[model samples]
Target: MSEFFAHRRPGRPGLAVFVNAGDPPLALLPELVAMLDENEVDCLELAVPFPGSATDGPVVRASADRALATGVTPRAVLDTVASVRPGLRRLRIALLADWSHTVRGTAPGEFAAAARDAGCDGLLLHGVPPRLRTAHYEAVRRAGLPLVTTCYAVSGPDAVAEAVEHGSAYLYLVAHYGRSGTAAAWDRKRLGAVTATLRSAASAPVAVGFGVRTATDIEFLEGLGAEAAVVGSAGVARMEQARAAGRDPVGELQSFVRELRTPQPSHTPADGRKRGIHP
Candidate 1:
């Protein structure tokens, strides 16, 4: 298990924030990661720049663009992560995997090793087969990193249950089957059922993402036994707002995080674990 996941066992859902490395700029990353830690994000997933993120929506795709435009290569991303990691003991990072096949002579093991050396907590391996090869998973395991996978566009209870049984280090449940955005009202009942099914099947905690935007959304996920709710578009919106208002984006982000982490009462997970506003 990754140190971060081991620190908190497989009970309640845990919040994991996805940030595009070099989004604002390479120089501003450390401060941004620090602010996220201060705001109570349990884990952070940094998306390394790729030419095409077919699954990402406007908010994240634009983030990718900025990062690539600034010449955010794998080495640079790893260096940035290493520089900032020493101070962020509470924040475990997951490196986003994309377009790995296109890299000449680069194996999946190489990417996992790079992430581990950069002090990442886990590997968010996207686009791989659902039933991953033992060698592939072992490659990540060798680096002391857990593998987190997403059930994108999948909504069946049985399917979710099966995913959990696979020893998923953590389950990334997409809030929408489509692209990422700022979502308002969600199908709480349906989501609740899915959460229940996932809890029943997997020992790993499950998190909801892709469309979560507000505190209410977070609260609803909490009610359903979701360990975490990720808000990407909203964060980008806040950054854009800060840029327009001529305020420091990082400063604005601090306030935004405060609002998101506001506490609430205990909720029940499908596994019957009590949910606390621990982070």
Candidate 2:
């Protein structure tokens, strides 16, 4: 395990948030990351924007579109992450790249090396074809970068095996099969067995995503034997809403992160408005 997860103790179920590289604009991203770090976000999955992601829903897709419209490239994303890494005291960044759109032209080993040099703690290659899995795994191994492997909660044994075997930094156990963060409700009985299976097999930390919105959900995941709960769509949506309302995007996002970490059943900010973090 990388130092990122190595230092995380068995308390405060890890909170990982996702954000597009340039959605808040590259210039302001460092500030956002700083806010996340100060507010105790365990990890940030920084994505290089691409179109038509199969796992993304409207909120995330719109965030990606906003980022791509500003002409954010994969290299630019790395540079931006590198700039924030020095200042981060706790937050670890995992570079999330779409394999076809962002990494197809680059050599796998070269891309992995670039991410490492940019101070990323881990690399998550999204939308990778199964036939090319060996090459991707080898590249990360050669670069000595931690790998964040993912599989759906309902995936077959082969998929589960692949994730557990290669996953070093963490394992992203997606909660459902549909687009990310679109599930109406979680089936606790079904997920309990899956979470238990992953915890038993994976040496890395197990973090579950998909429809994980509130602290209640986070607590529930912890209860189910997961090490962390990942909130993507809701996190991105908070930033967009802040931007639209002419509020401080980083400050607003920090508030959302604070809500997730708090152990209260009813989360109320200073303003006392009830915020729903649904995807």
Candidate 3:
């Protein structure tokens, strides 16, 4: 396992924050990455802008538009990661891209090599299904960069186990069954069941994401036995809000991170026995 995934311990669940590279602008990336690391963000997921993203919500789509408008290319995103890698010594950094972005008019192996050379520890192909991503997985493996795969609630234990057998650094579970940034409260019962299934079937850790917006949500995921909780659109939304208000985006992100890392009372029942949520 990479050092990023190794950060998880007994009591604390990991936090992964996502941001579109060059959304507000690429110049701010180094500082933003540094700030996240300083504030205890375990993983920094750097999203490369691609057109017509089917899974992106309005906030993420707007950020992608802004990034594309600023001429952010795959190469530029890689370069930015390389520049920030040294500063983020302990933080695990991963690149999130679509199949098109990963291919980039080159062979999959070649593209993976480029990303590895640019200092990314792992790669997550956002819209590609695990069964259909053999070539991409092999390429990432050949480059020695970990491949992060997504598992949906609907995808049963058999599928998740197969993905683990195929060698994923970790499995990313979609907390809800829709686009990112949807405001629905997570289905705690379903989430608990699915997480339990994944944990029992797979050796790799499971990280839940999609529609995760607040500290309470993070706490809930931790309670559900998730190895990490990913926050994408929520973080971007906050950054946009900070910029509009003439506030420091880094400071805003730091405040949010601190809130997430803060310890809170357990959700144990009054009888003092821990509730039966499967780990």
Candidate 4:
């Protein structure tokens, strides 16, 4: 099992933030990774830059555009991972790549091998074709790399089964099937049932993603049997806002992560920033 998922305890769900590898710039990622490690955040789902993603929202799509404009590539992302591996103490890096955009020319086994060689603790490949699913799983198995398989919350039995079976690290249970970060409301009842179902079937932990913005949402997911909440668009939005404002995106992230663990009032703000009437 991956170190991040090894010493699991029954408690509130863990937090995993996603970021485009070069949005904050590849040069500063090691520092950010170190900060996240120092804060003991569970996982950093680092995505390589890709264009025209069918599932990403504007926040994340904009992030990818920024990253790609800066010439971020799969090789650079993996190299960055390798550079930071020695400094890591607790935080694990999960490299998220798109099969169509990032791994098109490479074979599944080769891509898995490259990720394993690059010191990735886990991997989740997006946009995989149905015909290549078996090859993907086989390659991951051959490389002895932990896999993060995903299925929509409303996915049928076969899809869910494939996710649970191959997902040795964790199963990413998307909250709904729309573009990322666009859901106006979380389907609490449906999510609760599906989370319960996946947890019962999988030996590994099950994580919830998509439309998970607030700390309150994380709390609610914990109540519904999710082991972790993958905080994506919101995190990227915070980083982008901070970056544009001449603020430290990593510091902003640290604040965001801290807020997730801090107690809040009956209705906590989604952004978790305390505002003043005078300001």
Q: lDDT scores for all predictions?
A: 0.69, 0.84, 0.78, 0.83
Q: 1-279 in candidate 2: lDDT tens per residue?
A: 245544455676887899889988988998888888888778999898999998899999999998999998888888888887888888989889888997888877788899999999998999888899998898888899999999886889998999999998899998877887585566666677889998998888899898988887887778788888889998888889999999988888888888887786655466643332211
State the lDDT of candidate 4 residue by residue for 1-279, as single tens digits: 355544334676777889899989999999899988887678899898899899999999999999999998788888989888988877888889998888878865788788889999888989889998888888888988899999997899999999989988778999888888785556667778899999999987888899877777777778788888898998899988998999999899889888877644665366643221010
Number of colliding residue pairs in model 1: 2
Q: For candidate 4, list the clashing residue pairs, or say none.
A: none
Model 1 per-residue lDDT tens digits across residues 10-73:
4433566677777777789899899877665778778777756667777788877877889888
lDDT of 1: 0.69
Q: How accurate locally is residue 166 in candidate 1, as Cα lDDT from 0 to 100?
A: 45
lDDT of 4 at 148: 90
C-alpha lDDT of residue 133 in model 2: 91
Q: Report the poorest 10 consecutive residues by lDDT, candidate 1.
A: 270-279
In order of lDDT, best first, we have 2, 4, 3, 1
Q: After superposition, how far is residue 183 of candidate 4 from its true place, in Å?
A: 3.2
The true-versus-predicted C-alpha distance at residue 18 of model 1, in Å, is 1.7
Q: What are the TM-scores, per candidate, against the unseen true structure? A: 0.82, 0.92, 0.89, 0.92
TM-score of 3: 0.89
